[model samples]
Target chain A: MALIELRGVSKIYHLGGEEIRALDNVDLDINPGEFISIIGPSGSGKSTLMHILGCLDSPSKGSIKLDGMEIGSASARELARIRNQKIGFVFQFFNLLPKLNVLQNVELPMVYAGCSSRERRERAMDALRLVEMDNRAKHRPMQLSGGQQQRAAIARALVNSPKIVFADEPTGNLDSHTGETILKLFHDLSLKGSTIALVTHDPEIAAVTPRKIEIRDGKISKNVDAKLSGQHDGPKFAVGSQQN
Target chain B: MSLLNAILVGLREIWAHKFRSLLTMLGIILGVSSLIAMSAIVKGMEHGMKEAMIALGGLDKVLTREAPVPTWQSHLSDQARGRTMRDVEALQRSAPLIRMVSPEMALERVTISRGDKRTRPSEFVGVWPVVIEMNLHNLEHGRFFNDVDEANAHAVIVIGTAIRDDLFGSPEQLGREVIPIGERVQINGQTFTIVGMFEHYESDQDRKKREWAREHPDEAAQKQAVARGRPGYGGGGSRSGWAFDRKNRTVYCPMNTMWLRFRAASGTGNVPDPTLTDIDFKVEDLSQMEDALQQAKNVLLTTHNGIEDFSFSTQEGNIESVDQAIRNARMSGGIISAISLLVGGIGIMNIMLASITERVREIGIRKAIGATFLDVFTQILVEAVVIAIIGGLAGLVAANLLVRFLASLSPTGNTPIVTFEAMAMAFGFSVAIGVLAGLFPAFKAAKLNPIQALRYE
Candidate 1:
């Protein structure tokens, strides 16, 4: 069975008496250890789909399941629990809390997960180490470079040991070189059997992922499985080494 | 998240916006501090007024006398009768609440002399020994004449400190045989032994009156020199139709001794001159003062054959007026302080709303990180309460300091008392304001949609 399944999901918003369909009849499934990208231009409902999948929002109409639990039918408390235990999100602007240092920011999800402070500290440090941000753990978000901030955000996402990580334009604020470095980190994570759903408007960014779901006009227009194209980067990194 | 984490977050938000937080706290601080200040002031005023009332013989001292009827009206109505020793005895027997009746007859402008030392005639007050306590006078030396002295009409006197100094040398000569106890002094050609000396009791109002009189000696003496049969006594302007002249310079003797020795010089020279100038009735309990006064009045009326010649007056009436004024002041101060607190709560709410708006994105980020509505609500509410509490504490400290400073400057020796109850009340009110003021803003923040919040700038 797929780790996540979405069928006939739709989201409609009303603006000044006009009905705008942000997402229309989207059907999708994500397997464990998959590296996938949802690609679309601005206003293509890609961000809305990411919000629904991350459980930050519920579909206006849909049957959505995560880790065998229904997403759309879950209570707000349950959604929060799923978000804390089952999924992690990295946003476009490197959404690190400005007041907290890198280490405290990384420990946020674990804090929600009710992890003991000692365990949270150890796990957050390990996550920071995975993203090469451990040395800057004491620094606030604004003190770091755009790439460094995103690295800390990724550490925060991985701190909870979520089964699926969603990156919504994760490198949108970074230069190409930093963006490429972040993509390589995602690739390393995916190769190590950590499922990643990377959302981006850039086609080149989408091309690097093994699978792509291209969205247009609030609907999925094309789906591609490119496992063979990305085969050379697989099995190069140790699996579960960071987790253990 | 734990409560500590939420508190830490709230603290950080306040620290991040220092100026805005202080401005928001201004209302609570002002409210709570003023509450403390007002309480202290009112308490101090109450203490001062009570002291003043007690100094003026207090609510338990009632004076009764014949109602003044003009000579022309005296014939039309029953002749105005005087309050006498018989009437005093009658009230004592009839009024259960009347503890003691001190009848006073005065011998004014009589010469007092001992050996070569002599002073101008001061009024001599003849009363029972209980008048010492009833009039709140303290004996400086020896003892007041007791029942034996009154019943036997012994020619013994307790001179005021001023008269002691005049008849002898200065106060240091007191024990050195100058105006010594058991030594004789002459009042209106009659010799009396000095039995005691009373310490001067004067209030601030009395002191001010004395100061004014000293400043205008000629006018004061002229106004007071009238040989009116009853001298104006209690030194303040006549309010209750009588004045108790300063007791500091007068002589006190047994009523029988005064009447026997100085009756010719004291009253209208009529045989069987049974007129008593004033009667001092000490009620057993202050709570029953009105009833005691009424009962005494009935006794006097029936004894006088329903002539209604005597009128009753209590120092308690004066205390009531003072109490009413103090109560009004306290109520107004409380209302003003309450307004300040209310304004402070509103200010806190306004600031909290603004804080929520400014941190919409932050709220979104927290929400996305598995923070439920409860978490968000608690964080905002905690921030508001924290601000209010901090302000409240600051106000408490400020009010105490201000009260102490004001007390130090008071000339009347009125020290504002900051009771524990006042501090606790102010602090509790501040916290309540914080919670109440923070509620709506916290609710607004909690109700925010995570998606919409993240989208907000």
Candidate 2:
């Protein structure tokens, strides 16, 4: 069974008496331990799809299920609970709270998860260790380099061990070398059986994932699985690493 | 999120902007302190008024004053006879509600003199010995006029400390206390022996001042030296001080002595009137004051031939007026403090609004991490309440200092008392204001769309 399933999901907006559809009848499924990327340019509604899949928003008309529980009709509070327990998001800007240290920032998701402080501390340390950021736990985001901050943000995303993690332009704010390192980290995390989705406008970044879903004009233009097609090579991280 | 975590986050937010938080709390501090200080001042005023009321013969004492004949009884006005010993004797016999009566015959414009020193007394009334209890006088020395003095019309007088101070010399000046017993003084060419002296009457604040002065004699001497040539410096210049001063300047003599020497010698045609100048009495039960007054009125009506030319005045009217004045003062002070507190709440609200606006991105980040609307709301609300609670505590300290400063400004004025009730109430009010102030800002932050908030630059 898929970890997340979306059928006929739509998001409509009304601006000054004009109806604008940000998402139109999107059908998709994400299985456990799958590494996928949703690629599109600006204004292509890929962000909207990611928002809906991440439980940050509910669809206007759809049947959406996450981990076998229907959530499309859930209230805001229920959605927040689902988001806290079943999903995590990494933003392009490394959205770790500036006021908190890296450790505290990583502990934030579990803090909302209502975990005991002891448990939150232990789990946050484990997540930071997973991202090789345990040594920088006490450093604030502002004091860290771009790659370190992104690592910390990824630690925060994995702190709660959610069913799925969404990275929206995860390397958009970093240099090419730092971006390559972050993408390799994501590839490593996916190989370790974490279900991860990268949302980006760059095809090079999307090539790191085995499966790619391209969105255009509020519709899915292509959904490709390299493992099933046997026509595309595996993740090009080796080629990128050779260049590095 | 748990409440503890939310409060921790709120506290961190405040700590991040310490100067701004302090400025935001300034309004609450001023409000709470002013509220407490204003109540303290009103409390002081009430204390002074109550002290003055007690000095005016207490709450149960009633006076029977002569009034003009009513219009309906104008034809029988000639038959009207004023309050006299007849009415006093009648009330004692017929009015069971009347506890004790003191019929006074005042000799107006009286001056006592010994050697070259002389001073006019506030009241020089002739009375029976029962006048001591009727007037709440404390005879500190010698003895009151006995029945033998009243029967034989003895030329004896009992004076207050003020008259003693004037006739001989005050203890402060003579460096020794004078009893003045067995001393002779002349009143209008009539020689009278001083038989007793009442204690000096003063409010609590004045008593403390006097005792403090006595304890530090050198300081008292220096103060007197400085005030020697200043007009009204040593006098009872305050509004409520006169009550105590007037009580201390009284002179009393035997009622028959007054009738024989002063009243009997001066009348419309050289015939004694025999009418009493004042008739004052106390009731057995303060709760039954109305009934007691009615009974006394009935007894006096027959004594005055049903002329209705007299009226009874109870201290209750004076007490009501004093209470009304205190209520007015408290209301005005409360309103002013409440306004200041409201302004403080508005200040909190304004700052909270600005604070949430500054943290829009922060809110978005938290919300994206699975923080519910309730969590964000509680965090903001807790921050505001924390500011108020801290400000409330600081205000209490400020109020204490403010009250002390006020007391020092007028040392003789009633000392402002800070009650625990006032502090608690002010604190509760500030907290309530904080909650009210936090509501709009918290709602605005909680209702923000996470996507748009994340997009907010």
Candidate 3:
């Protein structure tokens, strides 16, 4: 069974007495251990679909299930709990709280999860170690470079071990070399069986994932699976050892 | 989030903007300190007023004075015989509730003289030895009149220090203590020997001032010289000091001596008016004052042939006035302080609103990490309350300093007392203000949409 299933999901908004449909009858499924990318231009409703899938918002009309639990019609509080336990998001700006150090930033998810401080500390350190950011745990986000900040943000996203992780233009703020390194890190995480969906406007970044879902004009335009098509030529970047 | 974490976050937030937080807390600090300081001043005033009340005898003392007959008994007004020794004897013999009765025969406008010095005593009363206890007098030197003095009408007198100061010389001027025992003086052209002299009566503040002057004579002399050069300087003493001054200007002689030597010679038809000037008594228990007054009234009624011409006046009226003044002072002070505190709360609310606005992006980040509305709300509320708590503590310290400064500024004024109850109440008010101030801002922050907040920039 799919880890997340969305059928006929729609999000509507009203502005100046005019109805605007941001999402219209979207149907999609994401299985466990699948690396996928949702790609589209701005105003194509792909961001709205990511928001609904991430549980930051509820669908106006649809049946949406995550890990076999229906959540499309859940209350705000219930949706927050689902978001805390079952999902994680990585924003383009590396949204680590500036006042907190990297370790404290990573522990924030479990802080809301109501985990014991001891458990949160241990899990947060482990997540930092996985991203090779354990050494920078005590440093604030402002002190770190763009790549390091994004790496720390990734550690925060994985600290709770959610069922799905959504990266929204994670490398959009970094230079090309740093962006390549972050994409390689994502690929390595996928190889280790983590379900990550990269949402971006760049086709080059989306090509790193084996499966791609493209959306345009409030509807899905294409859903392609390179592994199933037996045409999985890996990302254009050279496959090399991890670099810090 | 757990409350502990929220508080930690709140504290960190305050620490991040220490200057702003301190400025925000300044209002609360001023408010709380003013509240405590205001109460302390009122408390000091109450203490001084109560002291003056006690100086005028005590709460248990009641005066029996002559009053006109009621309108219903107007036709019988001519039959009224004023308070006299007969009523005093009757109350002493029949009224068990009346502990002691002192009959006073006052010679109004009486002048005492020695050599060329002449001074008018505030009160020239002829009384029994019980007058000392009735008036709470402290006879520091010489002997009071004995039964022989009253029975034989001895020409002896007991005078307060004020009269002696005028007759001979004040100890302050003579640079030594003076005991005028056995000194010959004349009262209204009648020779009398001073038998006793009561101590100088003065308020605690006045006593302190005198002692301070005695210790620092040079400074006192300089200040006095400066005051002499400037009119109205040190001329107006404390309002309550008049009570002490009046007590010090009294002169007492034997009851028969005042009647036989003074009133007897000045009465109508050459017959001495047998009426006593004043009849004062003390009750056994203050709580049973009404019943005791009633008992004395019943006894006096029998002696006066049911004339109903005299009435009772308890010290309770004076005490009630003092209490009313204290209550009025406290109410006005409390209102002013509470207004400042509310203004302080508004200051906090204004800052909290601005703070949340500045942290919109932060709020969005926190909400995106699965923080519920309650968590955000508690975080903001805790921050405001923490500011208040800190401000309240600082205010207590400030109040202590303020009170001390005031005491030093007027060392002779009533010393302001800072009570623990005032501190606790001020602190409690500040915290309550903090909560009220934080509510709107917390609600606004917590109700923010995560997406819109992220886009707030």
Candidate 4:
């Protein structure tokens, strides 16, 4: 079954008395274990789509189903519960709480999920090891490099064992090398059967995900697989294998 | 998130900005302290005045006098109004709670002289000896006047210690016969002789007694000295020792003697002269003082034909009133002192509010991590209450130290004390201030939107 499904979802914003359309009639389905990417220009609505799919924002129109639950009609409390239980978020800026060390950031989702402290610690360590960041668990985000911060953010998302992890411009603020490494981390997670939705303007990131969708002027313009685009440079590199 | 976790985070945020927290709580602290201070001052006043009144005389006695409706407003009349020799007799006859009661005659500006010894201006009041004895006479020499003196319109006198100094300069004046200025003693045309001397006394023994006497010169403290039997002096000027040449001073004399000699009026064509102004009677039993006073009230009420003009002022209540007056005087002062505490409470409140503003994201994070709004609200509220309680306790300790310092300044060696109520009230006010001030900010924290909060910088 699809973990996330949207049908004719649209969002409009009122800014200074002028209507701004952020999304329009977007329909998509993301199955569990699939690695997907949505690519577009800055104002093309991909980020807004990520926000809705992650349950951070609700659809203004149309029905949204997360793992077959009608999330569009969910109350604020229900949305919070869904956010804590199902979706993990990664921002380009890493979004690691500055006051928390790496392990705490990773363990945060489990803490919110009502897991025992011991259980939270155990799951956090597993996620950290999965992202190859177990050794830097005690360090604050400021002490980690761009690539490590993104890895930590990814670890935090996975600690709750959510059905899908959403990354917004995951490498927008990182160097090319760091960006490529972070994309490989997405590839690695996908190999381990973790579903991911990567939102970015970079074709390189879109190339890393097996399935790609393009957004233009607040609407989905195309659905193109990486093989269909004939972009194979990303998989050839094993970019996340820097530890090897 | 658990309450423990929320509190931990709230405290961490507060600790992170210590100075801001202190500043915010300033207002709460001051408001609490001011309330406590006013309470304390009132307590002190009550205590001080009670002591003063108790020392004046026991609360048991009542003063009675003959006063017809004067041209002035009767409402402003002294408590002694409506009491006459007849009222004293009626009270002495019918009150079941009767302790002994005595009557006094007032003589004004009477004079006396003997040979070359002319007495200075003074008072001459005829008094019964047993009534004087009711007041535990701490005589410097001779005893208070006896009933025999009242019967004979005694040439004998009981003088204050001050009189000894003016007449003979020592206790040796006990037996000396000083000439009254009137050749005997005169007040509206009557005369008497001085036969005995006693000790001088300043009415108030409180620390401010001398100062009050100094300031109010014409009252009880600042008056001229005189001899009882001097040719021109009146019966030794009551308690104040005023000067007179049978003319300017009012004196104290036995009511019995005064009634017989000068106060009696005939209902003929001749108009009667008003001679006796008032009478202060002492009671024997201190415990029965009120009962005696009530009895006197009932008897006098009827004797005067329901004249409510007479008032019975209790010595205890008088002293209590003084205490009340003192406390009332210090009400504003106490508030001023506690103003600092209010500033401190506000300091704490300010700190908490600033902290709420700074940790918006943390609150968002906690909520996102499963913290209930209740958890967040309680966390902030507890922090504020804690600051207030601590500050309030500190103020209480300071107040005690201040009271002790004031106590050291008291003449009786009694300390100005702080009651438990004051202590509790101070702390209670502090906490109240904290809660009241913290309520709005804590509510804001509880209502924060997790998504928007997470997005906050």
Q: Which candidate is the best by TM-score?
A: 3
Please identify model 2 stretches exceeding 4 Å from their true place: A15-19, A236-244, B64-124, B133-143, B146-153, B159-192, B196-251, B255-312
Q: Considering DockQ, which of the candidate structures 3 and 4 is the better prediction for this target? A: 3
Tens digits of per-residue lDDT for model 3, B204-248? 767877899999999988877776765541233455677777888
**Per-residue lDDT of model 4, residues B67-165, tens digit only:** 454445455444433445676577668876766666555555554443334444455665566445444344544344566766766544544443333
lDDT of 2 at B327: 90
Instruction: Give per-residue CA lDDT, model 1, range B1-457, as digits (tens).
Output: 7888778888998999999999989888899989999999888888887876777676678888668654555663545567778898898788899898888887667778888888863567788877877777888778888889989899998877667667777544343644468889887778889998876555555556667876987887775665344544432343531323445676888998877876744445566566787898888888887788888878987877666776778776677788899889878998999889999999999999988898898888888888888888999999999999899999998998889889879756777889899899999999999999999999999889888888898
TM-score of the second chain, cand. 4: 0.65
Tens-place lDDT per residue, model 1, A103-193, is 9999988877778889999999999999998999899998999999999999988888898999999878887777878988999888788
Candidate 3 wrongly placed segments (more than 4 Å): A233-244, B56-60, B67-101, B107-122, B138-141, B147-153, B161-180, B183-191, B199-249, B256-275, B283-310
TM-score for the A-chain in each candidate structure = 0.92, 0.96, 0.96, 0.92
Give candidate 4 misplaced runs (Cα > 4 Å).
Answer: A73-78, A100-163, A170-195, A206-208, A224-244, B1-4, B26-42, B57-61, B64-157, B169-200, B203-357, B360-390, B397-417, B439-457
Residue pairs of candidate 1 with colliding backbone atoms = B233-B243, B233-B244, B233-B245, B234-B243, B234-B244, B234-B245
What local lDDT score does residue A240 receive in model 1, on the 0 to 100 scale?
A: 30
Candidate 3 global Cα RMSD: 4.7
Off by over 4 Å in 1: A228-244, B59-126, B139-143, B146-148, B156-202, B206-251, B255-320
The all-Cα superposition gives candidate 1 an RMSD in Å to the true structure of 7.3
Whole-model Cα lDDT of every candidate shown, in order? 0.84, 0.91, 0.90, 0.67
What's the CA error at residue B180 for candidate 4, in Å? 17
User: TM-score of chain A for candidate 4?
Assistant: 0.92
Candidate 3: residue pairs that collide: none
Reference-based TM-score of each model? 0.77, 0.80, 0.85, 0.68
lDDT by residue (tens digit), candidate 2, A1-244: 9999999988998999998898889999999999999999999999999999998888999899999999999999998888888888999999889999999999999988899999999999999999999999999999999999999999999888899999999999998888888998998899899999999999999998889999998789999999898876766554355555
B138-186: candidate 2 lDDT, tens digit per residue? 9999999998999999999999998998889999789898889999999
Candidate with maximal lDDT:
2
Residue B280 shift from truth in candidate 2, angstroms: 4.0
